[model samples]
Target: MLMSAAHAQVSLQDRRPVLKGIETVDDPRRIPRKPAAKKSKITVLRGGRVFDAVSAAARSATVVIEDNHIRAILPASSTDWPTEARVIDVTGETVMPGLIDMHVHLTYPDSDANIDEQGSAVDGAMRGTRNLRWLIESGFTSVRDLNGVGEAPYVLAQWSADNAIPAPRVFTAGHIITGTGGHATERPLTPTHGHDYAIEVNGADAWRGAVRQVFKDGASVIKIASHFAPDEVEAAVDEAHRLGLKVTCDCEGIYTEMAVKAGIDMIEHPLPRTDATITLMAKNHTASVPTLQVYQNVIDRNGGFYGSTSRRFAMTSQDDFDVFKKMKAAGIAMGVGTDTIGDANKMIPNVYIAELKWFVKGGYSLADTLKAATIVNARLLDMDDKIGSLEAGKLADILVVRGNPDQSLDDLQKVDLVIKDGIFYVENGQLVTPRHVAQPLLKPSPPETTK
Candidate 1:
């Protein structure tokens, strides 16, 4: 039961395998980069239970992560493993890919229950740095941050890329584009709100300019509130795509329909989609991210406009469960995104467990539910080449739990080990980097006096 220490897929092409090619993808385990004979930083996670993220099945395997990358996965028992490298023996544990939450607010601060986006760029950067540490420690190795103040997300993205900071892999949406008074826009009554945060553009021409601004700022993904017109959605999609970026729209009513029609890449918050709408989405290759639990949080709060808690919760009650089943049956690309960003679910990893229940109620058999979170969502982020599955040569983003997650979804809450990019983040349920920052992480500042 010795898995080969060599596994590297030649990407930069379709699934065309080229085992013997000159231009190969970087393989840390490949034949010595040169004659220097570089040493490997290997970590053999000895005995553990692993969720076959690719196949969505649990398998007893010995996975070795070397030099911050996965080297191999062997189908063998963990009896007597090597002692040289960093090793973790989770004899009675389960493992899967670190979770991906497509919707999160790393820079959005809150007081009471309302999120505030009026922070300075530096403030956002500091908050994002702190949030990234919490995210990775909590088992989220990757995240699609919606929007943040200024270029704060981009700075954080660069930090994690260098591993100068250990945090979740970030796919940033930069800033949001919105119509005159869309959700992202500030209300006149709310003085604390930052009206300048969203790129508020009304006409198609204005949207084009905004898209150019976001592109200039290096946005990995484009996000716009489609509460405007179909023409507006179409214009945003055309411009954003022209710049080689995917567009995600946040909406519920006609906005969703417009977004799907205008060839939007994805939609957040799965509302009750119609049969015609579902068909259009399937045909147009559009995806829906049902941030159901987030919607539930809004319902729990029962704020103004949606006033009644029980009624608002019942708003998408029928639409919630069936939308996923119908989409799955219709062969539409339905990805997973946890929109719940406050209270207990504020910690990203906890949302993955609740998200399963949303799909479960939608007639998704347990296996498919897990797949949607791991592989399905990974593919949407255009990061399938590196992450998503427990295959060799991929970045070793793994999670080992106490019980089979499929049989009992709650088993994930009791994770024994979490490995991301060959780094063992959690060992036996205790994080290598603890989440809580009880004491101040900020350095000392000198006092200032005015004459």
Candidate 2:
């Protein structure tokens, strides 16, 4: 059997073996003696102010994208582009790296009515697919799903990577690993919802096993819950690191201290932490994704505090802001995440914008806030080297907004264009059909007979 070059390339890019029972021909004679040289498809954005995500400023420049990687970022005056390059004039626009969201739950319902409903896998898949499209259309080219329901996230991740669906690049931590009756396991386990949101395991060895299980299920990162012994957290962290992955924890107060001590790479929330723990986190370079917007939503929807009986009642929005300020003053690495579980259409831009505004309110400059959403969030995902900034040799995941977002984050909502992996998904502030979807799917070549 023979496979097309395109199919073989996709397999290699995925770092997975080809499907079973389809053996590729190994005969040298059957291969082309001299394959035709492929021409590079070049697209240039001319006369745009480029914000590369490194400097805290945008400069007038031209970006030359060749295939799926940036070829160069030339000066606005430079006309040194290939004659075949398709140039698009982007004067008065801002071209920057695509944004990233470090924390999201794609499988969760997008509305209040369905929030507590026990949906099946098919329902979860539908919701997740819808969320993925909303994320990409909103200028998020990459996202990390911290706790997805069942296999929905893993399957979605694969689909997004293969361009089988229109979605941002997805990195997921299959299910939350927690002790019995821990943070994520609070809901009653029904037949449909049992162990889909979280897996309750006990003991240090059990934590290690949970880490291994999620990794086997194609999770690139590990998410663990709090209220566990120090040794258990340590075991989970060690197992994840050994597998060449990072572990983040969703815990507060003493649990935060324990997770940090266990060498957790990131903390999920801006929960109350002692000054000593903050110092330790800064010293150890532990990253944080303070999902302040989610907590604020809880308070707002429930009228003031999340009710007097709720554990979160004591923590006010002001308290969340104060904790963020402290973390910033301590030089803790922070990223952007909304943790939105409402109507994506109504909540995405609003929730995401609110998160950025909170960062500004917490003493981050507008430029720095944008960085947190792009390169900084990429660093949190350990993917900065590939897709964080707009630079030569990086993936061509770029965004062009109508106004200067570095000066005012509100202008970020004007997403004029978005390009992921060199394919245009959005243009003129509208979503377009992806190239893969518009074209016929690649098929394997028929086997050739030996002469």
Candidate 3:
């Protein structure tokens, strides 16, 4: 016999459910060795024009990094240099904060794979690990995985943080939360694959519990889908905000309006939204990710429609593009995300670059597009104070590219170097495994010397 939603709710509230496979331990021999003790080192980058993400243009400057944080950004003419610092000369290059992708699905299969043949959790893990490499190589130092199969994304995030894998900083929403048979829940249900991508629930109370479940499972952000009752979404937003996590919704039309009104922090796509919905989003300061490239890909692949014949959603590429333009014009805060789930190999650099190009095509300057990808996206992630810009006392996630990206958007393709957490992940246009260094343990000063 199957359990009813009401009965399931009682069980969930009685005892927290642990995510499947979270407690499994890997073989000791397969575990990567712990990081070596951290040693402070001073490194200076000289002769490169820097785009601090706060400035209108890249200017000649010298950046000094101490350990894993930026110690200073000195003027080009200043000569007060640290004597022991190792300096790397980057004459004629552009140095800036590493790029961020506000949305991604790291567990999805390659573009050529059939959608119906979704893989197992182990397959998702392997696919995600491969995708992480492509992301970092393309200069994305951090990404937020909006959804993934089972516990795959969460496990991958932990692995990336532990330096057990060569990957970017990862923030993940373990599984999307949606109403029963809702958007992300449309996948074919089988015994093993059921609820792999999203959890289905009914009623406002169940909605709140769903939020708690994902939060307890180590989700850094909450992702919910629409076609839900107004009260249900409202309960979810309230619960997530109470837990100190921001909520992002994947919705269109009336659903979008409801989410914005319910205080959703972010909306996922540039799907059709009314003028009133746009106004409300701007007024409420709700940000949008406007994943234009993915929708455009759909149109291109389907001969001008945004969806297949059976699920057309009655929208077109131009329709979505127009909504994106209007949202930008309304002064709504927006970020960049490539909702490139399939064909990532062929789609990544192109999709990500195309998204920025669309921004420029819609009246944004080259510098504006760069900021959208850096600080603006960082702010959306609530990580602006730490990783967004080339500022002192910020994490050393810097990127050096061959040309002036602020002047020519295409120049961003020339990724010469990438530094995350002061570790060199890519140098001279080549990927290298960095030696992990763990922070030294602080010991209590020997019992205050009885002076």
Each candidate's lDDT (Cα)? Answer: 0.68, 0.79, 0.79
TM-scores for all predictions: 0.80, 0.85, 0.85
Per-residue lDDT tens digits for candidate 2, residues 119-207, read 55667788888888887888988888888677898899888877677788888898989888777656443322346778889888999
Each candidate's clash count: 4, 0, 1
Give the total clashing residue pairs for model 1.
4
Q: Identify the runs in model 1 with alpha carbons over 4 angstroms from their true place.
A: 1-39, 77-84, 111-118, 186-193, 303-314, 340-347, 433-451
> Candidate 3: what lDDT?
0.79
Query: Model 1, 406: alpha-carbon shift in Å?
Result: 2.6
lDDT tens digits, residue span 1-451, model 1: 1112142211212221333432222211112223224367777766676676677567778887776667788876543435677776767776677777777766665332333433667776787787877777666778887876778877887677556576777777778888866656544423113453567788777887888887777676788874577667777777777665678887766677877877788888766457888888898878878777766666656631342211122444445657667777888777777753444335556666777787887777788888887788887776676788777877788877777777888876776766776766667677575566577759875668664
Q: Candidate 1, after superposition: displacement of residue 99 in Å?
A: 1.1
Tell me the spans in candidate 2 whose CA falls farther than 4 Å from its real position: 1-39, 112-118, 188-194, 303-313, 434-451
lDDT of candidate 1 vs native?
0.68
Model 2 lDDT-worst window of ten: 7-16
Q: Candidate 2 lDDT (Cα, whole model)?
A: 0.79
